[model samples]
Target: MRNICAIIVVFFMACSIPGYAQPRHSFALGDSVFLLDNRPFQMICGEMHYARIPREAWRQRMKMAKAMGLNTIGTYVFWNIQEPEKGKFDFSGNNDIAAFVRTAQEESLWVVLRPSPYVCAEWEFGGYPYWLQNENGLVVRSKEQKYLNEYKQYLMALGKQLAPLQVNHGGNILMIQVENEYGSYGDNREYLEINRKIFQKAGFDGLLFTADQANDVARGFLPGSLPALNGIDNPQRIRQLVRRYNNGKGPYYVAEWYPAWFDWWGSPHHVVPPEKYTAQLDSMLSAGISVNMYMFHGGTTRGFMNGANYNDKSPYEPQISSYDYDAPLDEAGNATPKFMAFRSVIQKHLPPGQTLPDVPAAKPAISIDDIQFRETTGIFNILSSPKINQRLLTFEDLHQAYGFVLYRTKLNGGAKGKLAVMGLRDYALVFINGRRAGILDRRLGDSSINVEMPQGSVTLDILVENLGRINFGPYLLNNKKGITQKVLFNNQELENWQMFSLPLDDINAIKRSAAAKKYTEAPVLRRGNFNLVKTGDSYLDMSRWGKGVVWVNGYNLGRYWNVGPQQTIYVPGEWLKPGNNEIVVLELIKPQQAILRGIEKPSLSN
Candidate 1:
């Protein structure tokens, strides 16, 4: 046994040397533990989404994970961003899962791929393609043939890029997870079985596993495959549960050991002190229970990629743009004190003479004060071609996926009462004759507002914003944006609508005029410019601004709301240039000042 251990360490060390040919090793499930190259292997992993991190920072993030004493990297494949449009696939840039895995290999790390068709990682539509909702009678994450067929097609397409990288194919991927946390959604064993088969068909010929909370072991586990626990720490109970499913043998694994939790828009930023989890981690390590930290480093969710949560208990809680997850690493990829605590605990459990790598040096950060907005534009000024209809059409109905939509109609005179929007999916700004009337937010359960119509015909426009799609619980399938149904004036149904799909795919295309000296609640785009001597990571403080999205050099920096919790947007230095850089903000509400500032550190609070 000692000889085998020495050989494994030497082999890995050799693989780390430059110009060395990376050798593939076997990863198999033992009676009670994982076997790598016929030796017991304890998998220490960290979850980090490649899409959430900038492509330029992938290597640096991986190095940070390695320095934190992680041997494995876990990631989920988001279907929405991978295939934004039906049949149109993008595997390059940040969507490059293959490159991400290969980079993990370059760092001498193995990977656990969770290629989820429905990953409830607080991602938009739970990582599902928006086009799926357009299919009639297609129930997602189910046995519906339409959904299944689409699922299979997408998996196969993704397989072409990633399946060949599995461990069995001499790649670094050690295990591939089945559908993510299915027990929380359903108890259909057949649905899981179908998913397992689809993974195999997609060319993942490596060890397979299913992860669910402790109580969901029976409901979520795939028979004849490795069963892993999520959010569980009790060693005795973990062993008992795994043995019962493994025919009285062992290999206890906690797939998601959360050190900290994620935050939503209106809530306080979540933080778990290092003291709270260091002991649990030590206990698990001493018991040889392989563990994967849920998020070793939670990066930012750029663009309209951030998702929302909905259920009977909670109102619509949209996730903040900064995924920051409050994990061991901060949002900008800087190691936190929690990282040090975890590293110390992990180092204590390492084999004799084996040392964790030195922590990477902190990246430089820059701050700019008062970036001036010299130009402006409004939603009304930048209208697109509209689709005319008697009734309203949804974002999907017009083949749109994200951003804002404008619904315009002429209101006949002498009509005055409560303006009710039936099935307003998220939020809308009501306008009467080019003036702000009121606002309706689904988060507040607001469906209508009292309005008095003018004596003559007046233009009525409702600009609806897709806050984010429901990313978890039973509401995953109920994801359609921008007014899913009818709008009413008093109890009378309103008609003759012209719908403008504002996907906001390209912010740079929008023409801008001179900046407004004053402000209004109407949706307006403000442009600012700042010069830099050298580019480094920084946070754009949007605390003074109202609810809206910002773009740096045309790269959508994500959304910001004055709502408590997240106050600054993480601006990756790679997005900035040494000379002049442009910043654009689409403010939905008025602000006290038109000025913005860049801070060196993230202020994820109100």
Candidate 2:
């Protein structure tokens, strides 16, 4: 009897295990039909990058997604921000992947994780660490051994955090994408396979897929696997790509349906009407195709992490700190009319007994004002400057990635005619006797220009601005900050330049000092102060000033440019004071005066 009981127990356990252990749904290929767990399951997702949104607002955003009738949340994990330094990983605070995944789970939402160490979301360096470029002969996003090895390390690290959250692991992560939109770059089958292997090795044995625009699917989509379409607006294109890539499988998905766009320096503020996006959403839903909004919440860029885009010929165009992608959720986390329209459309198509949740209330906005400032250091108080190849270094060297670097050299020949730089990365304003003489822009690629210089023991100041780095394409891989070569006058490279490494990672370092000095070397700190009575979010207009970095109460607002597109700087409300706020301005050029004003809106071209 005991033996009979044991056999019955064994049989019961086997029967229970199959129900729990079966794969969430096999993404199988078939003619005219696609299956999810052998059943048709449509994905309604919303895309929102975690690093861009505030941690405190994650739940609210997820709730917002649910209210929009989204069953899934698609996110890109930025490798550069996650692991700023190689071997040192960070998943805490805003970088927490597990927190984000679990929050979606609590909201009964599935997840699509796009771990593209190369997410070109208008991010700084396209989400790549500048240090990676510091290495000799390091080619990114390819089958290169060195690049793959580093890539593997990051993949394994991310896998450790997310592998357990997959559907098979009792969580809701439904699909994982290979590299993003690779067809735009090349047709390397070997590279795509290697990426698949890495994901499998990292324990991500769940459903794997690839996303690309509709036209690029032929070259971009991997054969015999799930192919998701990105940025597809028309139903015909979506059907064509889905059938073409998935062997006529009918379940199609729009991986990145853009409802809004991003802004750069000198461009007007941007806004997309809700009516257009509503029409697109209605079309996709009515056709029974899954869709994910590119940016459900377009949040702030926060720090110096904003990137640029250049296609080799053009100058580097860096992105603005305000990532507010004209998304349904604005930079301040407020839901716009687009959010309501999307929610209504999705509600109209829901199966029986289902209703979308109510929209969440908007967060309170802080107000700031009444500011005053004072200066403590002048240009002459530097000791020495850093030189490259025995020549005074340009902003490209001394390893200054962003912001301004000051270079001072005593003129032995005295300033006279035709001052020129051998190479100016983007833009530079030259100064003689603490006065502006000329400016050079790389847009023209004309570094050699005439400039007026004064006589005997004169100080030559060249303030260089990081116009921005290319955030997309092959040129993105060639982004180099500061001056590439040396600055020259009439073909003679300037020497003995006093260099200042003004990356400005710290705000407390700025202090009150009343001293007149000169340096023959590198790393100089300039101090200044500004006052404020009330407090609110504002933009500091940095266009009048030459290239350099500005700090309000020690918060790094991001690089500024005299160049068009992004003239004004973003100053967050949290960085302001109720009364007098200290403003320290570091100018790499020779300027006699500094002036600033506050603007309520972002300055970007529409």
lDDT of each: 0.87, 0.71
Model 1 spans > 4 angstroms off: 1-22, 513-520
Q: RMSD, model 2, all Cα superposed?
A: 6.5
Where model 2 places Cα greater than 4 Å from the true spot, the runs are 1-39, 312-315, 374-389, 392-400, 443-449, 496-498, 514-606
lDDT of 1 at 347: 93
Worst 10 residues of 1 by lDDT: 512-521
What are the models' TM-scores?
Answer: 0.95, 0.82
User: Candidate 2, residues 183-274: lDDT per residue as tens digits?
Assistant: 77777888888889999899888878888877777777877557888877898878887887776775677888998888766566577899
lDDT of 1 by residue, 407-436 (tens): 999978776789999999888999888778
- Quote the lDDT for 361 in model 1: 84
Indicate the residue-level lDDT of 458 in model 2: 80
